[model samples]
Target: MTKPQKAIIIGAGPAGLAAALRLQQYNHISSVVYEIRPKPTTLGGAIGIPSNGLRLLHRLGLYDNIRLRAAETSNLVLHAIKGDVIGKADLTSWSRDKTGFGYLRIQRTSLMDVFYDAARLADIPIHFGKRLVGIVENSDGVTATFDDNTSDTADFLLGCDGIHSAVRKLYVDPNMTPEYSGVVNIFSLLETIMLPQARLSLDGLNATLTTDGLLALCPCTATNEMIYWFFSRQLSMPPGGGGRDGWEEKGKQEVENLKVTLLELLKDTSGEWGDMWKAIINQTNVVKFYPIFRMVLGGQWARGRCLILGDAAHAMQPHASQGVSMALEDVFLLSKLLEIPGRSLEEVYAVYEQKRRPRTDRMSKMAERNGNVRKKTGPWQLWLQECAISGMMSVYNLCRLDRLGIGQKELAYDVEEEEV
Candidate 1:
């Protein structure tokens, strides 16, 4: 009998967890996941899990449990800067279709908890506080050293450790670094209030382009108690002034400083819309700023037996909102590719990149274009673009590009690498 393969995944976030869950299905393989954050704490903001993300979760046996904890939105609303409704995207019919199961707007922590629980149920071991600091790879396997002075070796290593991935550092050209776009994205959470007019004006999960920046608000969870807000503008000060650039440990003072510009841009809004901002600023204890940056796909995703996925491989603007979904897609696709035989790990890794890179690259460019459109300042240009988007969305709720594979056949990722 062939010996069981062993794998180690760094980072227990959604991407890492999904990979773990898929690997768990192969009884012969022993897989372990390492996370930096311990239990009882979670990562940032409201994540809109479109039908694709939900589908992956469902396939992994986590759909029902997660759905029970999240809020489902039937429609997407578009608004003007002054709190006026420009368009309403009805998703009721789409939500009911086989492909369009709508979207679940859930707290990031809640989603992580569910994934963690599901992984536990599957007997997958996830070690917390194991921050990956270094990676060593050879033709035969890979070894990861964590901050806790622990190390593990596996037949293969998947670096789902996020943007500042240690694995990527080893292979990517040092000159082609991730450049910041000079925009600081401030994400805030607020107590959900029932103000149909305000909600419609801001466009719940439907992005809205305004004069100053892009403001997006979406429902989170089922209780109507929490909502997610994102506000962005060109940064006059450096990212997290006088502090490190990482968003994970940003200070409240910096967030407060950014809120000043946000408040000015939102000055015209009134009634419940204004109140929502006030509540968000006053009540929220947690906030984060992502200095938008884009990474060019330079290095091959895998070096020897070490591989990278998700933002670690392709960090792009969030305008596409596919960061998580794309990562989810990676888990399934990579799992299939790893199941393949005859070919070497490098060959399988190359195939995985060939099949996935084009799609992600296209989406990254689209997101950059979307950001440009949102940042358009000239009156005529902004109006024409918004009207065009509104018109397009009016007829078809799903973006044309998204519809092609929306909940359809899972991208036929290769399987010989993992097949027994």
Candidate 2:
């Protein structure tokens, strides 16, 4: 097999940045990250990097760098919207023992800054405002045509371009897309006085579910007085279906139509949760509505000399908060496989898809199922959750599902083995 000299990474988000950094370190792989979003530094949202993710950050020498900029969350508290203490679990103890670290709650922009700075330190060039227009791959390599009509070629092209990936469309089939889970994630961050009723420690996070839907309140690691809430409800799927491919083309009016519809669903919770809902809604901050959808992959994640990573391959619901973590996992696994001794690109890609696809697929299914159990109107389900909560001391413990593969042997590049 030929040595990996150059590669092209689409999207400068966490996954792409991690891949570029690791590949550069091990394979001395020169790369360029093409991102359509300009001013990537300004992108902001609350993102929780679990202990598993923290371990990877440590490997890249950015763990402490991120720790200084982010808040460490001990648990995810679960409560009844009606003000009843339901289930709680101590996530810090469970995961800390397993991975030697805890969860870090940081803004999306903050996390990106850490990754981007590390890439810069490693001298990885990131090309912003470059939209991919076309992709042509042959037996030897792949070429990417950008919206500016400029083109670049490399040994392989990695598509980390999120759910709506042009590279996926060009190399893979056009029909495979992320479908709506009948949910709209309405989230906002705002300054608020630390009220006594707020169950989350000014330092912790909460996942409160009612007969209405799910409301998650978590403190911002960057700001103590501010809190982030992700409010969502299940919606009925439209006829003929809605998905990532057809989502943007659905038009503002159609999307707006759905937003108004989701707003109406929140009506049931309006008169129930004190003025908490009012305070959140009336705050002088920006609120954004995102359509929640899960991607169902068709065929495989790689084709010929092209491969897709992150949301491009498997866009899962955010229930388990594993979206970015799984993407990080891809960085670890794929990069290690590529560094293998005498392995062809095709063989490495095949191994990566085989190892990762099942895990991500299982996680996606869990998110969908959990969404159903979290619906507020379900009496039996709520009762079951409440019973489980009582058996635990913290909200984190109550909501702890089967601890998945955390101690899986870390996949690292073995230079001695590869060289021999």
Candidate 3:
């Protein structure tokens, strides 16, 4: 009798948990997930699980639970800062018929809860507070050492540790680091009652483009009572600032200053829009700020038996909204590759990179371009943005681009059958 290969997954986010579930379904492999956090907690704002991600969750039997807790977003509305409706992309029936799932927006906490529950039901052992200190990989397997000096050995290691991955530093490339994208984001969650008038206007996902930034308001719950809103602006770091660390250390003060700035910027918007921004500011109890960063496109995804996925491998701007979906796709591809018989771990790793890199690179470049468009700094650029958005809207309405496979290629991936 052959022993089942053991896999070690770092980080318990969507990618890691999904990987565990898929691997457990295979007869030849078993997995355990190690999360640094003591418990599952909300890390950031709401997330949009697009068709690609939703389809995979559906396969895992988690779609129904998440759907019940989240809002099914059917349309994306684009508006000018002055509150004039510029365009819209309707994705109601198109998503269902084309991709087998609809885009869902929910709080990060809600999503994590579902993943956690699913992991538990699958009997996957998740060790909390296991902060990775170092990883050593050889021909036979990989060993991970944690902060407490404990270690675990497994047939392979998957780094889902996110953008600041310690695994990447130890194994992949020591020189590679995240580059700041010259944009700062401030965001918060507000109750609908606080913005009563604004609630009346939010029939769907709403976004406004300004000369210096973009503001988006998305419903986070099915009842439409809680709203997730964010502002991303082109801001340069002050001289001698420590970048991300500095932002974190001074988060409170910076958030307050950002709130004031956001209120001032909202004044540029026409009537209800301006009032809505003010209401969101006044009603929020806590505000968070972070400087956006992106990894350089195209890197070695695997070194020996250790592999990195999700934000750890290809972090991108939020503009494309493919971050989570891309992460889900990575694990799906990996799970499929691992199921093939007579393949060495290295061979599987190589094929995974070959299949995933192109798609992720394309999305990263598109996200960068989208960020640039949103950061329009001049009248000419703003005018160009309006024209481009309007044209795309016209094309989308006529052709139903979402249904025409605009972002469905990743979603349509077929999972391999379980070994009988």
Candidate 4:
């Protein structure tokens, strides 16, 4: 078989777009992206791009643009519910000379803008309002059919769609479904002024650990203290919740109701000074509830020139905060594998899976552990958690181990320079 060139990329997300760009840049593979939404995703309020993700973005010539739009967060400050500082992972001396980046926080919309603009500048075509419904693969090529009843043929197809991937459902793993992790995250963006009048510094990524759960506030925009606040709580999906985020009018109303419920639930945390946590929630006009989901990712990543990447391949919890970084790692490694001369899609898929799956599996376990530690707990467990966080942060800071979020052993793996 000839080397696969023309590619069909499903989902214009960070992984998909980055895959397309990398494929074009390194392997000279041309691609067309199909996204279900009319425009970029508003999935969450903001995200933190670690060094691993940033390095890949830099290789794609997209680093500068994203850097300009995001805020640099050097400290992950841990705090108790009563507003006492416990510890912090100072990323200042995190060996920037090695990883070439620290931690960056940016709004989801801004990051999407960078990707979309970059795709446009690179002359890649992204077809919006197209939902994939069917896929057919033959010796000659693979064809992707959308809900519109139209189809496009390519040398191969990639399911960069998402966790709930149509490519995975229709073509790859038809019987599989996203398993609810019994954890839900409530998140929103806010101005610094919106916070209750408290003598607290908003310079670092502030994480408040309550007896119930965890709440985090990170500076997002580069110029100001526009905070991207999110909290984790144990909540069940209503047999089939998470239909969508609170975007539409009906969904917005549902979030508003959840907001009121959350206020009641967190009433115990209110103090004589004021309900600081409740005030932040009450002032937030746009609140979103996202239930964490995970996919069992032990099987094949490809079948007959069709493969999956990013969340479509392995969806984990958010405690690790490495979702986008891992997705970018997937994009980087896959494209690098494809660059090997005269390699068929099958060989490329094999090599890609061999090198990628173990890493993702390890990450999945790490995320689970992180989530468990951050869960709501009793006083003894909470005290243990506080000690654990402080101790770990102290270690990280003393060794300047923040060489990247997670450091040299993981974040330092630069696939661009590694042998493919």
Which regions of candidate 3 fall more than 4 Å away from where they truly are? 1-4, 91-95, 241-245, 249-254, 379-384, 398-420
Which residue pairs does candidate 3 place in steric collision?
A: none
- TM-scores, all candidates, are 0.82, 0.83, 0.90, 0.89
Error of 4 at 147 (Å): 2.2
Error of 4 at 222 (Å): 1.0
In angstroms, the error of model 4 at 355 is 0.2
Candidate 1: regions farther than 4 A off = 1-4, 26-28, 38-41, 91-100, 137-140, 147-149, 171-176, 193-203, 236-254, 257-260, 270-286, 376-388, 391-420
lDDT of each: 0.69, 0.70, 0.79, 0.78
In every candidate, how many clashes are there?
12, 12, 0, 0
The C-alpha local distance difference test score for the whole of candidate 1 amounts to 0.69
How well does candidate 2 score on lDDT at residue 257?
61
Which prediction has more favorable TM-score, 1 or 2?
2
Q: What tens-digit string does per-residue lDDT give for candidate 2 at 320-377?
A: 6677777877887877788778988889888887778777787788778767754546
